[model samples]
Target chain A: MKYSMEDIARFAEGDMDGDERAEFEKVLQADIDLKSGLASYQNIHSSLKMKLSNDDKDKDFKQTLDEVSADYFKQKSKVIPITRYLAWTSAIAAVFVLFLIWSPWQKDLYRQYADTEMIAMVERGENSAALDMQQAANAFNKKDFSVAKATLENVIGAEPGNATARYYYAISLIETGDGAKARIFFSELYKGTSVFKYDAAFYTALSFIKEKNTKSAIVWLRKIPADAAKYDESRELLNKLK
Target chain B: MLKKLHEDHRYIEALLHNDKKVVQEIYAKFAGKIKRYIINNSGSESDAADILQEALIDIYQQARHKAFQLTCPFEPFLLLVCKRKWLNELKKKSVLQVTNIDDALLTIGEDVFADAELLEKQEAEAKHFEQMFEKLGERCKEIISESLKGDAQEMVAEKLGVTYGYLRKKKSECMAALIQLINKN
Candidate 1:
C-alpha cells in the first residue's frame, strides 16, 4: 500500500498516535520508497533546524576566518626573516657601502616612498565590476603585482572612468617594472579631478624617481599642493632630491 | 562505536567557538604548507586562502551539526580536506595541468579519509538542501522556517495567524514538497 507524504511526515515527526505510528512502522518495514522518503524528510528537517539555529554564528565564523586568512597571506607576502636579510647584507656589504657613499641621495627613493598599499575596495553590490574591483584589490594588497596588473587592466577597460582602478593599475605597472607605462596613467590621473588626483601626482613622481629622473621627479613632486594627500611625503622626497 | 577523540579536537572546538587565537594558530601553522601546495598546482595564493577557508568552514558546519570529532592530527586532516576541495575547484574551472600529490605522502589513516569523505558528503547535502529549500513556495517557506524555530506549535501557529492543525498540515506538505524537489535534482 502506497502512503501519502503526510503519513511519512507524521511518522518521521513523531506526530502519529501510537496505533497509527505502529501501522506506519509496519508499512515502513515493507515499503522501500516510503522509508527513503521519510529519511529525506528527516534529513531536511534536521538540516533546516541546524541552519536556523546557527546561521548567525556561521556568519561570525566566516568573518573571523576571512580576517585571519587575509592577515596570513599578507604577512607571508611581506615578511622576510632577519637571518635571510643578514645573509644577503653580509654578501653585499662592501659593494653597498661603496655605492651608498658614492651617491647617498641616489638610494632607491621610489622604494622609500612608494606606498603600494591599495585602498580597500568597498564592495558596493554583487555586480561583476565590484567583484573584479575586489579581486584586483586583493591581488594588489597581497603584493601579487602581476595578477593585480592583469585584473586592473580589465577593470580599466570595462570602466575607463574608475580612477581607483587607474591609480592602482599604474602602481601595479610600476611594481612589475613597467614604470614608463605607469607614469602615463599616473599623469592622466594627476590632471583629473578624482580623489586620487594628488596621490596620483605623488606616484607619478615616484615612477620618475624609480627611473632615476631626478628632474621629472622634482617637477611632479612640486605639483602636489600643500593640502594634498601626499603633500608631506612629497615634500620630504623633494627635500632629499634638492 | 564511539571513536577516541584526538588531542587536536581542541581545533574543532576552537572553530565551534570562533576562537580567533586558535584559528590564527591554525593558519600560522598550516597555511604555508597549503599555500605552497596550491602554488605548485597551478593555483594562486588567493586560491589557496579561499580553499583553506572553505575547508575550515565545511569542518565547522560538520562539527556543529553532526558532532564531528577529530580522531587524528588536525594538520593531515586539514591538508586532505583542502586538497580535495582544491582538486574539485580545479575540475570545475576546467583547468588542465594539475600536479597531483601522492596520498601516501600525507600518511592519512583510513579512518581520517572516511571521516573527511563523510564530512564532505554532509557539506554537499547541506548545500543542496538549502538550494531545494529556496525553491519552496512563499507560504511553504514561511511556514517551514517559522515552524522550525523550536517554538511551541501553538505559539508558532498564533504568530502566523493560523490554526495549529493548519500549521502542522502545511509544514508537512511543505517538507514533502521540499523532499520531492531534492529527489528530482
Candidate 2:
C-alpha cells in the first residue's frame, strides 16, 4: 500500500489521531519499504528543524567563532627573530666542548646512554604539548639545535610553569653551549616531582660536563636516585667524570 | 537514582546556547593543537580555521538534533572529528599525503572514533536530505521550508494565497515528492 504525503507529514508532525497513528504503526511493522520511506521523510522534517530555528543567532555565533579563531591563530603564528650568528657560534662551541670532554670510547658510552624520552612533535588531537614546545622538539630531533634552542626559549619565556618544556629547553641550551643556563634549568626540574625529574638530574650532570665543571657534574649525577630510570647510566657517567 | 552528567557537557551547552564566553574558552583551550595538526599535515592556517568552524557546526547540529551528551572529555572528541574532517578534505583536494597522517594527529579511543563515525553519518544524512530538498519546485520548497517551521498552517496558506486545505494537500504532495526523490537515490 502507498503511504500518502499526508500520512508521512501527519506522522512527522504528530498530527495523526491515536487510532490513525496506531494503525500506521501496525502497517509500519508489516511493510519495510513504506516504513523506510516514511523514515526518510521524517529525516528531512527533523533536519530542517535546526536550519529554521533563529537562523540569525547561529549565523552570528559562527561568524564570531570564525573571527575569534582566525585572530587567535594570527597572534600565535607571529614569528620571533633569531640571531643566526650567535646560534652558529654556540653550535661551534658546543661541538668543541664535547670533543675535548670525551675520548672515543667514552663518546660511544655517551652515545649508548644519552637517550632521553622520545620527543613527539606532531600532537594530532589533544595531548598537552604546546605549539612552540612541539616546534622545538621537531627542531631538536632534526639536529637543528639552534632552532630548537630559540623556539624552546620562546616557549619557556612565555610559559615558565611548563616543566616539560623547561626540561627540554635546558637540553636545547646545552646543545647550543649555554651550559650555565641549561644547568640551572635542569636544577629546577630535578627539584620537582615532574615526570622528567630524574632524567633532568642526569642531563644536568651532562651540562656541567659540557662546561668542563667536573665537580658540579659529579654532584648532579649523584642526585640520581637508585629507583630512577637513569640510575645505572648515571653511575657509569659518574665513574668516568670522577 | 539520577546519574550526574559529565562536566564537559558545558561544551555542548555552550554551543547550544551560543554562549560567547564558553565558545572563546573553547578556542583558547583546544584550537592550538588542531591548528598545529593541520599545518603539520600540509594544511594552511586558513584551512585549519575552516575545518574547525565546520566541525563545531557539526557538533552543534548533533547536540540539537540528537541531544548529544559528552560522556568523555571534549578534547578527544572534538580533535578526532576535526582531524578526520581535515583529512577527508585533503583527500578530496587530491593533496599528496607526504607524511604519516595517522601518527601526526593526536590519538583517541574507540569511543571517540565511534562518536566521529556517528557524526559523519549524521552529516551525510543531512546532506542527502538537503540536496533532495533543493530538487523540489520553488513553491513546494517555499511552502515546506516555511510551513514545517512551527508556523501556523492557516497563516502559511494565506501568505502563499492558497486555501488552508489546499496548503495542507500541497504540503503533503511536496513532502511525498521529496520522499520519492530520496528513495530514488
Candidate 3:
C-alpha cells in the first residue's frame, strides 16, 4: 500500500519477480484502490500495445477484409471459393469453373436447341414450279448446308411469307452461317402470326448462338410466350442461364 | 485458473498468423448469420459488413493482446457482440426499429459476455489513453509511446537520449499525469 507509482508501474509491467511479485500480489489482494490502479495501468499499456503493433497490420487486414467481403457479396447466393482467399482456391475453383462450363442450359438445353438437325426440309407445300422444294428438302436432309442454303433462298424469295418456307429458310440461313440474314427472317416470322412465331423466336435465339452472343440469345429466347410451342424449352434455357 | 482451449481457438491463431483461408472461412461460415440478423432487424448488408468488420477487429485485438484465448465456440460470442454492436450503431443512426431485435440465439455463458465486454472496455480505455497521452508535454508523449515499443527499455531510453534511471522515473511521472488527465475528464 505504501509503494510508489513506480512500484505499481513495475507490477503492471510484470517486471517484478519472485519475492517482489509475490509481495505485491499480497498487497494487491488487500488494497481495492491499489488493484484498481494496477488494472488501469495494465489496460492502458496493452491498449497502446495493440494500437502501435496492430496499426499497419489492421490496415492490411482491412484491405484484405474489404476484398473478401466484396467477394462474398458477389458470390452471395452461390457459396464460392473466395477469389482472394488464395492458396488452392482452385480446388473450389474447379467447382466454380465446372459451374460455368456445365450449366444445365449451356450443355443440355442450349445444345438441344442449337442442334440445327441438318434442316429436315427447306421447302413447304405445293410450290413445285416456284422453286425446287423437293430438291431443296433432299439437299437439306443430306446436311449439305450450302446446297440447302441456295435452294431455300430461291424458294423464300419466290414465295416470301410462306410460313413453312420462311421457317425452313431461316433454319438454312442459320445453318449456312448467315445469321445476319437469318435473324432478318426469324424476326419477321416472330413478329407476324405464324405457327412458327415461337419457333422463329427460338431460331432468332439460335442465330445469336451462331454469332457467339449467348447473352442476346438468352434475351431472344426469353421472348417466347408461355403459350408458344417453344415456351417450355425457352424457360428451361433461362433456368440454365440462372 | 487455467481455461480450456476451445477447438475454435484456430480462429485466434488464424488472425495472429494472418491465414487468409481461415479468415475467409470465417466470413463464409459466419457472415450470413450476422447479415440475416442485421437485415431482419432493420440494417442492410452494408451495415452488416461494417459491423462484422468492427467485431472481427475486436476479436483480433483480444486474440493478440495479453494472454487472451478463446474458451468457447467463437460463433455465438462473435455474433452476440456483433448483433449488440449493430443494434448500438442503429440506435446511433436513429433508424426505425421494425421487428423487436431478438437476443442472439446463441447460449452464451456469462464468461464470454464478460470477455467481450472487457474488450470493449479495453478499446475505450485505449481511446481515452491516446487522447490523454497527447495532453502531456511533447517529450513525455514521444517517450511514453516509444517506451511501450521495444522490450529493451534501456534501448528505448537510449533512443530517447535519456539515462536508464531517468526513463523509469519519467515513465511513472508521465503515466501518472495521463491517468490524472483521464480521471479529470
lDDT of each: 0.77, 0.70, 0.69
Q: Which regions of candidate 3 fall more than 4 Å away from where they truly are?
A: A10-39, A55-63, A73-242, B98-100, B103-115, B158-164, B182-185
- Pick out the ten consecutive residues of candidate 3 chain A with the lowest summed lDDT: A117-126
Weakest 10 consecutive residues, lDDT, candidate 1 chain A? A74-83
TM-score of each candidate? Answer: 0.57, 0.55, 0.54
- Using TM-score, give the best candidate's number: 1
Q: How close is candidate 1 to the true structure, as a TM-score?
A: 0.57
**Candidate 1 local lDDT, A1-242, one digit each (tens):** 47887778867766678888888888888888888877777777777766655555777787667545654553323222223343565457546544553466756777666645564333223346556777887788678999989998887787675666788899999999999898889888767654567888898888888888999999999999875657877888899899
Question: Considering summed lDDT, which 10 consecutive residues are worst modelled in model 1 chain B?
Answer: B99-108
lDDT accuracy of residue A102 in candidate 2: 53
Candidate 2, which segments miss by more than 4 Å at Cα? A1-5, A14-39, A51-54, A75-242, B1-7, B104-107
Per-residue alpha-carbon lDDT of candidate 1 for residues B127-170, written as tens digits (9 for 90 to 100): 78888898888899888888777778899999999998888788
What TM-score results for chain B in every one of the models? 0.85, 0.88, 0.79
Pairs that clash in candidate 3: none
Fnat of each prediction, in sequence: 0.52, 0.38, 0.34
